[model samples]
Structures are given as C-alpha cells and as structure tokens.
Target: MSVTGAITSGDASLLPGKRDEDWRWTDLRGLIRQIPAASPQGAAWAWESPLAQAGGEVVDVVNGRGRSDLDVPAGGEALVAWRFLSTDGAGAHNAELWVSVGEGGKLTLVESYEGRGAGYLANTTVNIRLAKGAKVERIVFADDHAEGVSVVDASVELAPEAAYAQTVLTHGARRQRIETRVAHPGAGAELRLDGAYLLEGQHNADLTTVVEHLGVDGTTSQLTKGVVRDQSRGVFQGRIVVAEGADRTDARMGHHALILSDRAEIDAKPELLIFADDVQCAHGNTIGALDEDALFYAQQRGMPAEVARALLTHAFVGEVIDRIEHETVREAAAGWAGQRLEL
Candidate 1:
C-alpha cells in the first residue's frame, strides 16, 4: 500500500487523535488546516559541513521526497529508500528510510528535514536495526521554515550486546512533532536518546519517545530539553516499558522546559511501565519559568536580565548538547540554538 494510503487507512497507527494513546496530548487536527495540498516553490537545498561527511550515509527528505548521494556501506542489508507525498489537502508527506546493520558492524545514519513554504507538512520516518555486537549512531536535524509543519518518527531495534544512540535537534516551526520508539529484542543491549528543541514566535514543537525493554539485561536512558519564547509552545512526553520477562533492566527518562515569556507555554509528561519482577525504572518532567533568584543575583552582579535568562536557558539545553559525541555536530547545534534565541 502507498504511504499516504496507509496513514489514511489507519495502518500507520500514528495519526493524531484522542483514540491514539501516544498522540492524545498534542492534537494534529488543528495543525492540518494550515497545510496545503499542493507543494510550494523556492525550496532551497544546501548541505553544510560536518553533516556532509562521507563516512556515514546521509538521507535528505524535502517536502516528503527522498534524495541521497551517499553510498551504502558494504555488506549492509535491508536498506529501503522511497518518497511519500501528501494527498487530500492534508499538507503533509512522509518518507520512511530503513537500514539494517550486520553483526559486529557499525553504521551511522543522518536524516535531514527541510521545507518550502507555508502550508507544508513533512512527516518522515527512519528505522534502524543493530545486529548482535553491532553499534549505530543516528542523528536527526530539522530546519523547517517558520510556516512549515513537520512530524518525524524514528524506531530502532537492538540485538544482543548491541548499542544504539540517537540525538535530535529542531528549530521550531508553525507546528513540529518528533516521535521515537526503541525496542531491545535481545539481551544485554543499550539504548540512549538525547533531544533538544528551540521554539520562538508562535511556533510549536514536541518531542515524544517510547522505549520498550523486551529482552533481559537491557538498559535505556533519555533526556530532552526545550526553550520556548514569545508565544511559542513546547511539549515533551516520554515512556519506558519493561516487559515481564525483561529482568535486570535499567531505564531513566527526564524532560525539562524553560518558558521565556508569559505568553509562552510548556507541557511535559514522563511515564514508566514496569511488568518485570526486578527492574529499576524512573521518569520525571518539569516545566517552570526563569529563576528569579538567579536572575536577581546576576543582575546584582551587573548582568542584564536578558543576558541572565539567555545564559540559564543555554545551560538547560546545553546538558543534552554536551552529550553529543561529535565535536563539530555539537558546535553546529549550539550555534543554531544561539541564533534562534538571538543570543
């Protein structure tokens, strides 16, 4: 079946609605009104350094069409490439990319999302498989326009003794949502996810994730942070699920948001589901305004309020930024955040 058909027929199961448990918090119905059925013009394509490296495969999706010049590594299996277009004036198109790493092999996947104009929706998905003893790092970046709307879905499956890590960065749009799902299908696996969102003006963004421990001796960790300014809105919802047979599982999840204006808003919900007899899993969520005491102290020390707030916001999001293993990627993300905050 076609991608658009699958979504409209409820086969994808990620549609936004009250019946969908994972999408109950953020409604996509309202955002659909802003997207147009036809594609827009003047969509520019550019690849900055660090992201254009040839070591790993790079996949670029523009308005739901897939384009890539990177060559697949030798011995790689089950790689898929396709484009998804939107119909019925929904203003959203989705493309799904799949990569399966071989046993004891390493793979890096980079996915980029860019848009053209207002009333455009781009929904993209990436699936990664790590065989036994294999390792993979996945990085995703979204540079959508101010009037664009985007939704990204990423899923990873880990085998025994495998490692999977993912980092996501987004500069807010009219409405943007990123959802991640990770599952450990074999014992002794590890998964880590880090995400950051910077929203300004009337833009809205959300980062939601779910990690399922289906194997014994599996571990997972996730940290997400957001900065909302002007009249923007940010949301983060994360869940960790430990199956009955998955003993010795260790999982932790946390989300923090900094609201920079009275008009700005943030909503966070972190959850844990444990069916195992012996396991350690916890989750936390926090949404608060800038620290008055800290701002006052900084002011007393001759620092301006704007500078103080910027510093604190940077520090909050920097936690995830520091976890990025690549120095050049980390610096690029930090620079993007700084530009968004006008700091």
Candidate 2:
C-alpha cells in the first residue's frame, strides 16, 4: 500500500504515481524507473545528530534496521532521541517503528533523519498510539542527502482526552515526501500539526497530512510554511474530515509559502470535509514572494540586503519553530533554519 512496501517486496505494481491523487505531485513510480538493489545492513551514523548534545535514550535505525518499538508506562514521563540514518548510495531500504504512551504518560520525541550518499532511496513508517489522558510532542528534523530520494509516513491514533502535537522540518532532497495521518476519537481530544521547509536547487519536498474526526468535540489545528529558491518545488496537502454525528468539531488548516526565484514553485491543497452541520471548519492557502515593503524597510535601517532578507525570512518561518515545546529542541530548530537562511 506504500512505495516502501512495494520497493522492499519487489512489487512495482504497488508503487504510487501520478494516477494516485495523494501521490500525484510526488510521483514515486515515475521518478524511479527501476528499484535499486537492497541496501547492505549495519551502516554507521557519522554526522552530528540533531539534538545529540541534549542527551536522552538514543534509538538509531541504520540502513533500515534497529529497535522498532518504544513504550511509556502509565503515568510515566520519557524523553527520547529517535534517529533514522541512511549511508548507502547504491540501493533502497525501509523501516517501521511503533510507539505507545499509556494513560497519563508524557513523551517528548526528538527525531532526526540523517541520510548520506547519493542516488539512494529510503522509506520510513511510524505508528503511534496514545491512551486516554496521554500527551505526546514529536519534533522531526530531516537532513537528507540532496541527491537521494526519501519518504516518511506516520500514523497516529489518539483516544478520548488525549493530546498529540507534531512539527516537521526538512531541507528537501532529489525527491522527498513526509505524510502524517491521524485518527481522532473525539470526546475532548486535541491535535496540532505543523511543518516548515527550506528548499533550493532542483530538490522537491512535500508535506501531506489527513486528520479524521470520528466523534464529537474534537479539535485540530494545522499550519505549514515553506521557502523555495532556484527551480526547487514545495508541496503541502492537508485534509480534515469530520464524519456524521461528529458534532462540535473545530478544525482549521493553512498553507503559506514564499518563492524567492521565478523558476521556483509552490503547490498547496488544504481541504475540509464536514458532515456534521454544527462543526466549524476552515482552510486557507497563500503562495507568493517575500514582503517587498518590509524588506526595503529593513535595508533603510542600515542592514545589508542579505541580512535584511534573512531576518525577514527567519521571522516568517520562526512561528512554526517557536511552537516547539522543548527549549533545547526549539533552539536547535532555530539554529538549523538560521544556518540555512544564512541569518
């Protein structure tokens, strides 16, 4: 049912492409003419892992192999650093991981995707479950090889009274996509999903998410912002579906981006489907260049052109970075973006 599934199983027939509505922009089948050979096992992570200095239980999946599950006991609290690393440029591989948080448990996840080498393919799938009254915050930073292709799919399930929040940041690759789907069982549960990307060259990045509210009194909030230069591309697809009888569901989704070059592209689709008459749902999308007046204002104040541009861009994307709850993780995210924007 996934590109990773087809690649690992050698079933090209199952690959997703332009024919599939969700994968049209990504078009994995078209980009990959032939699946590469299987990747070798036991590749080491040699880069400075994100949030590594913060210190926590480290779980690494190298070359698609490592511990595949994590659990937080009832009323427990945990801080974990989960990493996915790809070091081979010759072939394709995949990994699947599961995380569970018991009732009243709290979990903070600092995740990283460390990919190296060129012309490789990598896929990762994660499933998360939260019991009633549980709380979870996941922050994912993707630093992949610019010449490689990568995809990440995550599914989240939340029981009544549970809360889940997530933010994803990526620099993009030859072709990279991150998809998140959430199953929301209302009864006062809450969800927040956010993403930010800085893409350049001919690279591509896609952030897609779907949240389905099956019961009453659920709330969901989503926002995504991206910046692209050269001929690179950025895509954001967000959909929220509230089934019949799912009354009092409040959901809002927004996608905004800035294109710094005439050749760059940004595609966004934000949708809301409400079967309940009393639900409140809305969606918005905006794609354009930076604020010219603001840029000029900063320059007039004595800042150089590049400095002014970087300052404005940083403030624009900093909204999402500021949402990261962990202090160390938030600073790390800002530093990553600042370095990319040359701030």
Best by lDDT: 2
For model 2, where is the 10-residue window of minimal lDDT?
42-51
Off by over 4 Å in 1: 1-3, 6-15, 33-35, 38-44, 48-50, 53-59, 67-91
Q: Residue 186 error for model 1, in Å?
A: 5.0
For each candidate, the alpha-carbon lDDT, in order, equals 0.70, 0.90
Per-residue alpha-carbon lDDT of candidate 1 for residues 1-343, written as tens digits (9 for 90 to 100): 2234534443433346545566655666533533344343223345654445434333344445555232334344222212233322335565667777778776555555665456666667667767788777666677677786677777778889988888888877787788888887638788889898888888877888888899788888898888888898888888888888989999988888888789998888788889998888888788888788988999999998788888878888989888876665667667766776668
Model 2 CA deviation exceeding 4 Å by range: 46-50
**Per-candidate TM vs. native?**
0.85, 0.97
- Name the candidate that leads on TM-score: 2
- Candidate 2 residue-wise lDDT, 1-343, digit = tens: 5787787787766678889999889888887877778888766655474577887788889878899999999899999988888885547888888999999999998778877788778889999999999999999998889998888999999999999999999999999999999999999999999999999899899999999999999999888999999999998999999999999999989888999999999888888888899898998899988899998898899999889888888898999999888898899999999999987
Clash tally, candidates in order: 0, 0
**Alpha carbon lDDT of residue 41, candidate 2?**
78
